[model samples]
Every structure is written in C-alpha cells, then in structure tokens.
Target: MATQVTFSEVKNNGLGYWGVLGFFGLLVLGGVFAFLHMHEGHYTTGMNNQVVWGIPHVFAIFLIVAASGAANIATIGTVFGQDVYKPQGRLSLALAGSLLFGGLVVLLLDLGSLGHVIEMAKGALNFKSIFAWNMILYSGFLLIITLYNWTMMDRRKIAKKLYKPLGIVNMAWRFMLTMGTGSIFGFLVARQYYDAAILAPLFIVSSYVFGTAIYSLVLMASFKLTGRDLGDIVLNRLRNSMAVYLVLVLFFEMTRHLTNLYATEHHAVEAYILTGDSIFTSLFWYGQIILGSLVPMFLVWCRFFKNNRLAHVTAAVLAVIGGMIQIYVILIGGQSFPLILFPNAEVSSAFFDGVNNAYTATMSEYLLGIGGVGLAVALVIVGMKGLRLLPTSLADDVIDPLNLEKK
Candidate 1:
C-alpha cells in the first residue's frame, strides 16, 4: 500500500467495513433465502418459462466474461513484454481466478440440483454439445489461471517462469471460453438461434471491454482505498484503454443490432429486446445507455479533462456498471422473450399457459450467487492482504513503470 495502513485501517482493507459487512451480511440473506427456497421449491426466483434464465444467468455470465478479461491484462506483459501494464497485472490475475470460481458457484446453484457437479469434468469429452464442453472448459480455465497466478512457497519462482506461456495460452483459452458461451446461444438450430453466428464474435469483443473495465475500476478503488498514488502515467494509459474499449463496445453493440434488423427471423428475439416494451426499454435505456454507455464515454473522452486517474476510475466503473446492464440485456433480456412464432401470426411468450409454471430464482438460487461473490471477495481481500496486491516496487507518478515483460 502507498500509504501507512494499520489493522484498524477500516474493515475489509478500506472497502468500507460496511461494504464487507454487508457482503457477509448477504451470505446470511442468501442462507435464509436458500433455506426458504429449498423447503418451498423454486417459486420465488422471478423466473417464468419465458424468462427461465434470469439475473443469475446474467450474473454468472458477467463473472466468466470478467474473469477471462482479467487474464488479458497479463498478456500485455507476459506475451508482449510491456511492463508499463504490469502494475495492474497481479490484480487482474487474482480477480480472474476469483471471478471464475465465483461464476461457477453461481451457475451450479442455478441448476437447482447438484446431480452432475462432479460430472462437469467428464463433460468435455462429450464434444456433442458446446454447452457440455463449457462444463469442462471453464473448469480448466479457472485451473490454469489459479495455478499460474497462485504463489507456491516452493514453486513460486518456477511458477513465474510460466508467465510467458500462460500469456498466449490465456488468450487462446479465453477464445475458447467465449466461443463456448456464445455457442450456448448460437447453435440452437431448432430455434432462431441458428442464425446467431455473429453472436460469438460479439461475445468475445464484449468480454474484452467489460473485463478490462471492471478490473480497471476495481484497481483504482484499491489504490485509493489503500492510499496508493496511481500516478499520472498509469492513469492516463488506463483511461486511454477504457476510452478505446468503450468506443469499441458501442460499435459491437450497434453492429449486432443492425445485423439483427437487416436479417430475416434473426430479428425475432433481439428486435423485441432492443426496441420493446417497458421491461426491456427501461433496462436498455436507463441501465445500458445511461449507466453503461454515454456517461462513461463522455467522461473518458473529454479532452479538456486532465484528471486521468478520476477519468480512468470513473470510466472503469461505468464500463462495469454499464456492461453489467448490457450483459443482462443480452443474456436475461435475450431470454425474457421466448421463441414462439406460430404459422398464423407473430407471437411472444411473456407468460405461460395451462398452469403458472414456477420459474423464480427461489432463495437458494440467490444465496448461491451471493455466496459465490462473497467467496470471491473474501479470497480477493485475503490475497491482497497476504500478497499486498498494491505495487510494491512501483513509485507513484513515475514517467514509466518499467515494462517487466519486455525487458
């Protein structure tokens, strides 16, 4: 830490005692919720047949995307030998490992049954279903990251040696993860998803943006809370990266929308989401556009503003805040409107018939998601405390942080 910190330096290492307290408190919320759901069944989760994959899906997807993106920061150094990016690399790596684990916890909990939790390992060999492979792929993804990032008392030096290989491998692994996730939506030939070929590329691109954004913001907060100076150079470069990502993410989203509009039947699900009723519009306009897009863009791209640190931090925060909403719109919003086009006329599945099928998340579902994040937070905080996640040899505002990977 840049500043002198003490044991009583505030709860959870300046994340605010309240933040940590609440975070832990949620475990209680989740536990109580889980108990209720397990006893009563999944009738409380806000899920319907049309919206089967709700917020938990969005949350789970967010972790995976963010997890992969976190590792990309490591590439800037290990693969490219650009150490100016190194200051943020450790945090990126740590969070990547933590988020992947957290996401798995959330996803498995959503399944509502732990029948195949271990069988998830056997899934990759199947190759019959892309989703099946994800069971194994993400597991390996987390493993490689953990092994590469974790500090082994005896193997610490040896582990660092793997950085270079891990860099390139990390890139490839992320490619697989994104492709696997996209395939979940893309390869639905039985439905309109057959035309979702473009979705995979967009998913990868979005991961880059959202992942970097979240890590950047979290690091900024870490610095400020820990009393470290980010220096102008580091902040400037990060802001530049955020600005670039924000613009690129916008391009990807816009392009996807246009493509969906131009093609026949492809527009069926997405169209309703982009230009639909209150639910979708509110999330897109208020959540995506406002929280995710325009605000961050203006802040990061402002020429007159020399406050790179603030710009960097704000942009990163907005990127995650907006990206979170964006992912929700894509994942949950994508599911909100089911696939139903009878031969006679256009149709939407806002509700189910015959009986009120219970699609809600129930208590257990939310608890699992909460617990996953809690696990991540606890792990991250402990990692930070143990390893001093802050730059140890780094000086604040140095002209260059020294490219560890390059030289």
Candidate 2:
C-alpha cells in the first residue's frame, strides 16, 4: 500500500493541553524579572565583571544550537529522500524557527543595555565581528525556514518542486549557523577555554545530540497526548541516532580537552574543569559526563529499553538535561577560571585577574534561563495548535519505505 501521509492539527483540547500551556505561560513571566534586572542593572544578578556571560548565555546558546540541529529531520527527508522522516519534515522547520526565536528572546532580555540593541542594529555592520555575522545568519534562517515550510505545506506542484532545493539550502544554512555560533567562542584567543579550532565541529556534534533528543521528546509527547500511535519503527531509528550522537559528543569532548591539556597554559582551565570547586566538579563529572553521556548511552543501548516507550522517554529527558549541563560547564566553567594575565607570577587586580572568580547565580538569572527553555516549549505548543505540523498517523505500516529493501 502507498503511504497516506496526511498532515493534521492536534485535535485534542483536554486538561493536558491547557496545563502545559499554563506552565509555559508562567515561564513567560521570567521576562518581567529579566526586564527588572535590565533596568536596575546587571549587578543584582550573579554576573559580575569577571563572569560576564553567566547562566542566561548557557541557556540561550544551547537552544540556538539545538534549533539548527532540529532542522536535520527535514534535511534527512528532502535532501536525502528518506520517506520515513518526511512525515516529520514540517514540524522540524517550525520548531527550528520557534526555538531560535525563544533563545533570542532570553539573550536580548539579559543584555544590560537592552535599549542599545536597536541602535547597534541600525549602525553599520562590521564584517570582522562574528557577532555581526551571526545577526545576519539568524535573520536569514527565519526567512529560509518560512519559505521551506510554505513549500512543504502548500499542495502545489510548483511548491513541491521547490522543496528539495530549498531543503538543501536550509541544510547548508544550518551548518553555517552552527559554525558561526561555535566560532563566537573558538575565535576568542584571550580565553584559554575557547581557543581550540575543534570547538566548531564539537558544537555541530552537540547540536545533533541535543536537537534529536528534544525532537524525540516533543514527538513522543505530542503523539501520546493526542492519542496517536508513534511506531516502534520510527522511535527505534531516533533512539539509535541519538545514541550515536551521544557517543560522538563524548569523543569530541575528550579530544578537545586532551588537546588542550597538552599546552602548559591550558592547565589552569583544565584543572578548573577536572578538579575545581564542588559545584563545578559535580556539574562536569556528574552532570555532563554521568547524567548527560554515560547514563543516556546506557539507556539507549540497554536490553530493557529496547522497544520500550518509557525507556525512550526517560532517555530523551536525560539527554536534554545533559545537553544543558554541558553548556553550563562550558560557558560558566570557562569564565569561572581565572584568566592568566600574568603567567610568570601570582597576580591580583580589581577584576580578579589571576584568581578563580566566585559566581553564584541569583534567582533572577535562573528564571531568565529556565524561561528561555519554557519559551521554546511554549512556541512548539502554540505552533502545533495553529498549524498542520503533525502527521495524522505514524504507524509502521502506514509509512512508506523509501526503498524496497526494508530494514
């Protein structure tokens, strides 16, 4: 039988829908806290002169990275002609746009000079600034994704003809976006934690793991909530893919750190990551490595989780948490370690130039960061209700195999 891939809106309007919406609604209030901080000054938050980026950056950067990764579903379908992933193509584009917007919201809100954002935008662009190039990349992403969506959703032969080429364009665009975002840190030579060229590809790999984990969770949850059958066939494919991404993340992280450790100057930063204070050590070893990497890999490959829905959901949640922790370790941990201004001798200055800086994130920062995630979730929820994003059914037999040689 030919696959009947009819797109449909979620018809359910039960307590679950409203409850989730309400949860995200509360998260939006974090914007108010952010605004207050912006008005009062950044001093009220955990961010000091030393630790400039803080947790808000950690959240914003992760969502933005995952946003690029989320496009991989559509890339797999249109670019490679994978029929199984085609059903997910529309929602992937929608999530990509929404998640990027949400992360942008948190990032803009956290800026000390929120009003100056417009002034800066109006000014001439500096080609040398990675930040300036990112502004262009992000704006272009929204436009391209919108056009891609129109092609996928509109039932016109001309639009259908446009989908494949546009999909290829989007695939390439997302790669550039990931590369630019990673280069934001990688290009920073003064910072010992971020000078490695490997960071660009590492960001790409991380996006793969984070994006897939989030898409899996959202897919499974949306289907189950609306009483749809997401087949083992599809779930297993995603589960396996996520496991491989997790492995790739581990490999890249090890390679990056090992390469850094070889340089004498990088030792201080490495020590901070490996044997720092209780919080840093716990987040790196326990959160990033243990919860983020090893545990999820175990769950993905475990005999008990094979074909088990509960196991897949649990693993997905763990992966998301792990992704966040990894970002936290990289962003916060990088700044927490004292910059080596005077390599020859012990140094002290008003900026705490040669000593490990103490940073304790305030409730406001936490609200703003967590709210960014909530904002992304809210966007997905609203988008589903407003558009035909989900497939009517994803049963094993209902989807057409791309080729006759079936797995």
lDDT of 1 by residue, 6-80 (tens): 111112544474575467557646744664464444566676556667666777887787788777777675677
Give residue 270's error in model 1 in angstroms: 4.6
Candidate 2 residue lDDT tens string, 79-190:
9987788889988888888789888888888887778888767886888999988988999999999999999999899998999999999999999999999999899888
Each model's TM-score? 0.82, 0.96
* Top TM-score model: 2
**Worst 10 contiguous positions by lDDT, candidate 1:** 1-10
lDDT of 1 at 107: 75
- Model 2: how far residue 278 lies from native, Å: 4.5
- Roughly what TM-score does model 1 have, to 2 decimal places? 0.82
Pairs of residues clashing in candidate 2? none
Error of 2 at 100 (Å): 0.6
